[model samples]
Every structure is written in C-alpha cells, then in structure tokens.
Target: MSTTPQSPAPTGMYTPGDSSAWSQRYADAVMNTFGAPQRVLVRGEGARVWDDEGRQYTDLLAGIAVNCLGHAHPAVVDAVTGQLSTLGHVSNLFTTPAQVELAETLIALVYPGLSAAESRVFLANSGTEANETAFKIARRHGGADRPRVLALENSFHGRTMGALALTHKAAYREPFEPLPGGGEFVPADADTLRAAMGEDVAALIVEPIQGEAGVRPLPEGLLATAREITREAGALLIVDEVQTGMGRCGAWMAHHLLAPGIIPDVVTLAKGLGGGVPIGAVVATGQAAHLLGPGQHGTTFGGNPVCAAAALAVIRTLRDEHLPERAAALGRRWSEQLAALPGVSEVRGSGLLLGVALEEAVGHAAEVRDELMDRGFIVNAPRPDTLRLAPPLILSDADADAFSQVLGEVLTSRTTREARA
Candidate 1:
C-alpha cells in the first residue's frame, strides 16, 4: 500500500532562537512609541497565542479588551473576508449596505426604544477618532460661548488632540500643550461633577468605568447626577464607553448597568466593537444627534465595507451566542477566584474588564506580570500595584479555570521564593 509521506510535525512558525533576532528587527524597523514589544507573537488561536520562541500563553489581556470574539474568530474572519472580496472602500461620498446595517444595529442596541431618526452615528477608525468626533459634536452643540469641556480626574478618553484634552492624565495631557478645547478636570464624585457643570461647560465627559486609572467604577447615582447637572447647564453628557462598551461589561453598553431611564447625550465606542477589526463610532441622541450637519466632519475610511461587516458579525455573534451574559457569569466567577489568590488584595471592574489589586508585599506589579507571562498567562499592569485582566468574552470555562489555577500557582511560587530568599 502506498502511503502519503507524512509532513514533519510543525515545531513552530519561526525557527528556534529567532525571538531575539525578531526583537532586534522590530526595534530597528518600528517606532519606539510603545516602548518595547513584550513578545513577537507568531500565532493566535481562540484565547491562546504563541510567541516567536514557541512559548504558549493564555491571553488574559485580549489585546487590551479589543478581541471580543478572541483571535482568529471564524465569524469575524469570514465576514471581513467576504465583505472585502465583495466591496472594500468606497469613500464617504458613497454608502455601502454593510455600513448602513452596522449603523442601524448599533442604534438599535444603544437606544432600543428610540426610532432610527431619533439617533445618529458617526463612524471612525479608532477610539481616539471616536472621541475626537464626539468632541466636535460637543463643541458644535455648545457654540462659541460654552468652550469648556469637563472631564473626570483619572479618566482616560483617548490620545488624539481633542480626546487628549478630555483625558485627565497630566503626564499625557501636559506634554501635548494647548489641546483643542478648554479642558477642565473634575473628580468623579457627584459634588465635584455638579460643581464643574457651569454655564460655560460645553460637555462633561466621563468613562462608565475608568480603564487606565485602574478600572475604577463610578459611584452609584453619580451618572444620574451628571445628567441632571448637565441638563441644567445646557451641556451635553458624553459617556466615554471606548473601554467599557461592546459587551466588555456584560452589556452592550456599560451605561445599561446604571439605574433605569438614564441616558447620555453622546456615547463613544471602539475596542471590541469590530471583533479585532479597527472601527469606532460616536452615537448621539436628541438635539445632539443632529449637531454634526453637512460639511462639518468626515473621514476617508471611516465606514469601509469590510470593517462594517466585521462589526455586524460581532454584534450578531454577541446576540446569538449570548456572550454578554456569559461574560457576566464568567466575570463573577473569575473575580471571586482572583480575590481568593494569595497576593490579590481586591478585584475591581465589571465583567471581563477587571483589575486585580496586588498586595504591596508581593513586590512590584510588573514583576508579578513578568512571572505570570513566564508561566504562560498574559495580563497587564496598568498601575504599579494593579494587574488588569481584559480577557476575551468567549474565553471558555475550562480556560478560565485553568487561568485561575495557574495564577494561584504563580503566586504561591513567588511567595515561596520570597521566603527562601
């Protein structure tokens, strides 16, 4: 019997000892904007990724909460590929069915009770672009008299000129001098938010759950207070959902977690919306919805067919698979497990957007992160003592349990090593 020659069992995509070479090449070719790359990832499948050195890792960060459906999700892949093959970019002068359908879907999810005409969407390419668009809407809605835009202290909006102005990090904002608008910073407390909502305020932007500042959640009733104050001041309440929306917080939008019958004028969204494809949107309602009229703002590749198709697919999958509810249940279980770990002081954030505050005695958060990475777990240290985990929404139960067990083991090992030392 003639047997087909067996292909060599694939060791890895890259040859052995190639990681250092790849890192050197990356340093030479790429800009140093993001410091150094942690690892030269060679492949990703579901919640697992392999580096150039052939080391495997369970992806807990999920590209900073952008991979809602996980890496190489078939739905996103097929949708993007099919849409690209059918029709790609067609400029703003033209409209594609995918773009229109995606917009309609977002409006339906974000404002369920409202009619199509009651809401409007402005598509962009990234979180920064989405925030930038919202900034423009705020400026237009407020007019020249109201130039001040209020943002909460420790809030993270985006890095663009306008969005950076709304972002409250001095280290990030101070370097970029004279941002687009008169940016005002205030605490997230109700009293501070109210005091900052003066007549000159164009908009008061706040994240539903602050991501960069250790995933801190806003106090209950503060959003309602913001709504009332902004309304009294004739200012817009812009909720920066870039990190908290698109099922990251077990809801289509984190605002849904608030008390009944609360709505913001503008909501900015990006990460996880397109299931890894680059896309962002600014959804507006009421008078603010119509603020951006003709000849005001535009983008060249904002609503390209492929990205829209990817977003539509992600939305469909989130609904059909009930990933948001899954994320809620998984988040609760994972948070409890993490809280039980040796070095974890507390667990913050909702759903998959979570942060594990490490005990100060556990040494540096960066050290813990490196140890976890060495043990095949990927997480982020947003602060010196906070380990952030924004894992994929579709992370399986087995994977979740495995990650918890591994994290516990890593912590135990560290403790043992410290005692030995």
Candidate 2:
C-alpha cells in the first residue's frame, strides 16, 4: 500500500523561530492595548504550557485566573464539543436546557435561602457585561432620580464605559473623563462606605478580594458592614466576584466566606465561570431581580448554549473533584511557603489566589518573571513590588513544590546580589 504523506504541523508548534511570525501577525491584527504579548504559547496540558520556543513552563497565572481547571481540560472540551454539535447559539427569544440549568445552578450556589420568585439570572458574555447588567438593574431598582453607584477605591470592575465609571483608578478613568454622572468612589473602609450611602445611592459595589490591586482582601468585618449599610439605605450590595468566584478563593464565592449571612442584592460573576469559554452572569436577589423585565436589557451572544454547557461542566468538575477545598489547602500551603522565603516580605490572599510582596520593592518584577519563565515557571507581576499567583486548582503538589523550590532559589540569589550591589 502507498503511504499517505503526513501534513505539516501548524507553524507555531514547538519552534522559537516561528514565534516572530506569530508575534508579527498579532501586532498587525490586534490592538496594542495590552502591549506586546509575553510569549507565543502553543499548547498546554494541566497547569503546564509549551511556548512557541519548545520551552515548557508551569502556568501560575492561569490566564489571569480564568482557567480554573487549567488548559484543555477533558471535561470542558467534551462539554463544549458536545454542546456545539447538538446546539450552540439561540437568541433570548428561545431558551435552551443548558441555559436554564446553568442559571438554576448558579442561583442555588449563590443564594441558598432565596427562592426563584425572589431572584433572577441575567446572562452575558464577559465580566464587564455582567457588571453592566448589574448597573442597569441597580439604576432601575432605585428609580430614575436616584441612580448613584458607590464603588470602592482601587477597584477594577471592567473596561466597559458604565463599569469603567465605577472603577476608581485615575490612570484608567482619566482618559475617559465624564464617564457617567452617577458613579462615585468610596474608600474600602466600612465607615467611609456608610458615609457614602444615602437614599440617592442605588448600589454599593465591592470586590470581596480586589485582584488587580495586589490581591487586597477586604477587612473581615467590612463586607458585613457594607451589607448592613446598604440594606438600611435601601441600596443594593453588589459584590463583584469576577476574579474571586468559581472556586478561585477556595469557596464558591469569596463573599460566602467573608459574610455567610449577608446576601447581596446583586452579584456579578465571570472569569472562571465557563473555564475559558467566556461567560458572565448577573445574579440578582429580592426586588433587584425584578427590575429588569423583557426588552429592558438584552445581548445577542449572551447565554449561548455552548457557553452554558461549558459552565455546567466547569461547575460539575469543581464539585465532583472537590476543587474548592483543594484550592483552600494548597493556597494556605503556598502562601506560607512563599512568605517564609527570603526577600519575600508578605503574602496575602486566600485559596489559589495569592500575592507575594517583596521586601526591596522589586522594580524588576517583570525581569524576574521572565527569568522564572526561562526556568520553567510562569507567573505575573501586577505591581513593581508584588507578584500575583493564580495557578490552576488542578495544579499538583509536585508542581507547587517545583515552584516553591525555584522561587526560593531566585529570591535568595536576588537577595544576595542586591546585598552585594
């Protein structure tokens, strides 16, 4: 029999020479909002990834904490493939089984005591869209006259206009001045939030753990106090769990751990929800849920069956594998180990999400990250002095040990060199 000629592998497969071509293509086609990409990643398995250069690295960032189960997870893949084959997209005019199931699942997970009549779910395509829906719901609940939104300082909701208005970073908000009149920024403290709360305020949005601001968790009593204050003021307490939800913080939602009794009027979820399929949801309770009627808010691709199927798989995998508890244990272990290392001043955050603060303000955090990548580890430097780690919940003990060992060596070497310098 004549042997069939094998087709050539894709251009980006395991070759450094092909990296430039991919980067050039990316530059030509994509916007420069994120600057140059770090490395041309080819493929991944579990928490490990192979770059275009054939170099292997343990991915600690996990696509900015979006990959809860890591790369190419069998469950996620199977769910998406199966759903796409059977049914993928349908407008809001029609409801799919996956969509309804996901909504019910999220409602059950997010609000245990709340009944269906007291709450509702609105699906979207990203974290920003989820927040946008929440914003709209809050404004509607508060009526037209009182549409003010009180958000915390140093918080990052999303990049969309309405969500951007509530985001407090001047660097991000300056360029887009006069965003929306009703958005206001308050400090993270309870007293500050209470002072900001009034009849005019529609909602108070807070992140249980602020991800982009170096994994700063809100003070223990702060979230409960926010709920009380908002409730008394008749304003919604909207928790943005985009980064901290879906088992990332070792819990279904970070707010659940922070204040179990306090149920937010609105909760926005994304990031790890679909395990990389791109999905966002706004879970509203009480009157807030009833604010959005038909035609009030809508999206073309939101709640696509494929995304819903992916999310259902993610939720099921998290439960079946008990990934949340694993995240809790591993997070504590990793944080403790990293904190004990030399040159590491502090370690903050819960679960798989962590931020390591360097003693000497490592101005070259990016350089350290590059070096770490060379040494077969992947991580992120959110600030000059702080390194954020959000590895997959599926990351093995061996992987964690490898990271700790490498990190110890790097920190010691850097400390010694700095002392000499």
Candidate 3:
C-alpha cells in the first residue's frame, strides 16, 4: 500500500486486517451505547461496505435510512468537500448561502403548497435534534394553557431527553424517567387519537411511517385524522419524518404521499436529509413558523455550510435523477418478489423502506439476520419477526435479487431444521 500523505504529527494506528484489535480499541475508547459494533467497516462504495478483513457486504440498511444516495456518491462528495474546503462553518449568528438554500429547498419539498415566506426552518445535527427542536416548538405554540404533547404508540423519536419523552417505547423511556414532562403516547388509531385530542393538548406528533416499529406505514388517513383533530383542538400537528423523509418512501416526504392535501404545522427531518453527512431540520409553517422567535432556540453547528451543502446535493440528486420514482418502482417490484418467498408471510412499507414478516417456522428475524450477514448481506431486524430493508435509493436490481434469493434459502433451511427438531 502506498502511504505518502502521512500526518506531520502522529496518526492513530488503523489495522486493515486485524478487526479484533480495532474492536478492542473501539471498546476501550467509545461509549457502549450501541452494545457492540456489528462490523469494523473501513470503507464503502455505493450500496456495499468492506470490513477490516476486506470482506464485503451489500448494505441494505443504508445507515438506518440515512444514506439516501448511498456511500460516496459524487454529488454529495463534491458538495461536502467543496463547502468544507471553502466555507465550512460560521456560527449560527452568521448564515451561509448554502444554509439559506437548504432551508428553502426543504420548505419547498415539505410544504409545497406554502411559499418559502410562509414557512421557517430550524436546522440541527441529527434526527434527535430535529425532534428536540420540534418539541420546543410545540411548547412555544401551546403556551401555558396547553402542556400536553401527544405522540403515537410504538414510535421512536430521537434518544435525547425531550425527544425520548415524545418516544413511546417503555424500554427507551423508563430508564430515563422525569423526561421534561407532558409528552405521552396515544394509541396509533384514528378513533383513539380523536378521543384523546382535546382543547388542552399542545401538539400531536405522528410519523407517517413508524420506522422503529419495523417500517410499519401508518394506516391510511391517519395523518389526515391527526391534522383535523389537532386543527379542531387548536393544537399543532407535528410530523416526525426523520426516517421517512428525503425520498425514503418513494416520496420526498412520506406524509406527502400518504396523506395528500393535509398540511402539518411542524415537520421534523434528518436521516437521509444529508445523505449520511449528519444534518436534520425542523420545518414549521403557518402559525407554527413564528413560534420560536429569537433567543428561544439555537444550535452551535446546525446548518453548517458543509452539511447544508451535502443536503442540497442529496435533494438535487433525488430530483435530477428521479430517484424517488425509481425507489417507488423498485420497492414495489422487490416487495412483491420478497413476499413470494417461502419464509415471508407478508411485506410492509413503500419505496426502498420495507419490512418482511417471516413465518413462524422460519425462526426469529435476528437469527435469520445473522444468517444473511454471514452470506454477505447487511440488513436490520427491528422486531423479532420483521426484517426491515431501507436500502439505498441507488441500489441495483442484482443486489436486491441476491438478497431475496439468499433470504429464501436461509428461511427454508431454518424451517426444515426446526420441523425436524
């Protein structure tokens, strides 16, 4: 290997072949929040990654719905590198051209009916920050009269205190009790939401598709019901599109496709927004747009030029390449194909985001996930029986077919062995 650009000081050692050493080093330094690293991935190109041992795997998870355009896409590379080199960061006090452009672009996509002047954007570093900002916006909009913020059950927002309060999962919340207060979960049903939403409510947040709930798309008209209920109750309707936005579900924003003609007061974004460069946004419209005002909220590195540029590139690439349409086409075809497999009983979700429900005979999804990993495929098991697939928008048909074929073999063998046992 050629090594010419050595650091003037000393660079940390990186072993290309010794993953165990790197894993130990990581455990020694990094926090154990995510349990353990799945693989010591060194580099990636388009929908594939390589470990320290140079073993390759098709990356179907796409960094948990963040890498929309896939790894090292030229547009994102050019925009991020160019912006970083020239004008990387200026404090929130000083806005860059890229920041302004990205905000407008997001508004256009999130609220196409509303003019840029009618909407406002608060940029942040991740999906969690975006949800945190949305939480604050709900409080500001509701004022003292309305302190109740309602989210749907089985929802997963960011892990921060405020976002966690809005998240419904007990395991993710009970450990960190006393979370800001007033955030609660309502059953994800129109009847329950209608009954729960009242004059005292501050806001109701809903994900068009509850991603952490294993890519489960909300029942049709759910967002519409939310919009109407919240509107009647004088509460803001916040759509947490962190995992479903930026062309993940074959649409720029899943809400647009799932619930057309209904407008949300606040929409939180991240994940694919920066195509893996780490950026998020809270886009608010109408009355919600002016709630924060000055000094109410701020961030140090939010909307830095580099991330903004990266987001703009992702958005532009999506539109220019018609990737959302492609995702729609491929998602439908792949879902049908996967559903026909002997192991899969049902398939859920849209665009590239999918959840395959394994039959009971096929064994747990985690066990199957490990089997697939061993066969050079990287996927996610969000639930015990559901395998979530959020592959890159640019994923090739060949990889999709290979994954399906391998999954079928794994499922059949597991089923046969289980039947025998």
Top model by lDDT, which number? 3
CA error at residue 57 for candidate 2, angstroms: 0.8
In model 1, what lDDT does residue 177 have? 90
| TM, every model | 0.94, 0.95, 0.96
Off by over 4 Å in 1: 1-20, 416-421
lDDT of 3 by residue, 1-421 (tens): 3223233223434446642465656676789999788888878899998887888999999999999888989999999899999998899989999999998888999988677887999999999999999999989887889989999999999899999998888899899898998987898899999999888899999899888898898998788889998999999999999999888898888988999888899999999999999999999999889988789899999989999999999999999999999999999999999999997899999999999999999888999999999999999899998999999999999989999999999999999999999
lDDT of 3: 0.90
Q: lDDT of model 3 at residue 411?
A: 92
Best-first order by TM-score: 3, 2, 1
**Candidate 3 wrongly placed segments (more than 4 Å):** 1-20
lDDT of each: 0.87, 0.88, 0.90
What lDDT does candidate 3 reach at residue 50?
Answer: 83
RMSDs, each prediction?
A: 5.2, 4.1, 3.2
Model 1 Cα lDDT, one tens digit per residue, 19-92: 24666656767899899999888788999998877789999999999999999999999999998888989999
So what's the TM-score on candidate 3? 0.96
The ten-residue window of minimal lDDT in model 3 covers 1-10
Q: Model 2 lDDT vs. the true structure? A: 0.88
Cα lDDT tens digits for candidate 2, 1-421: 2233234456544455442466666777789999989888888888989878777889999999999999999999999999999997888899999999999999998997767767789999999999999989888878876778989988999988999998888898889887976998888887778778899988899999998888899988999999999889888899999999999998999998878888999999999999988999999888888888888999998999999999999999999999999999999888898898887889999999999888773436776787788788999987777889998999998899888899888878877777778
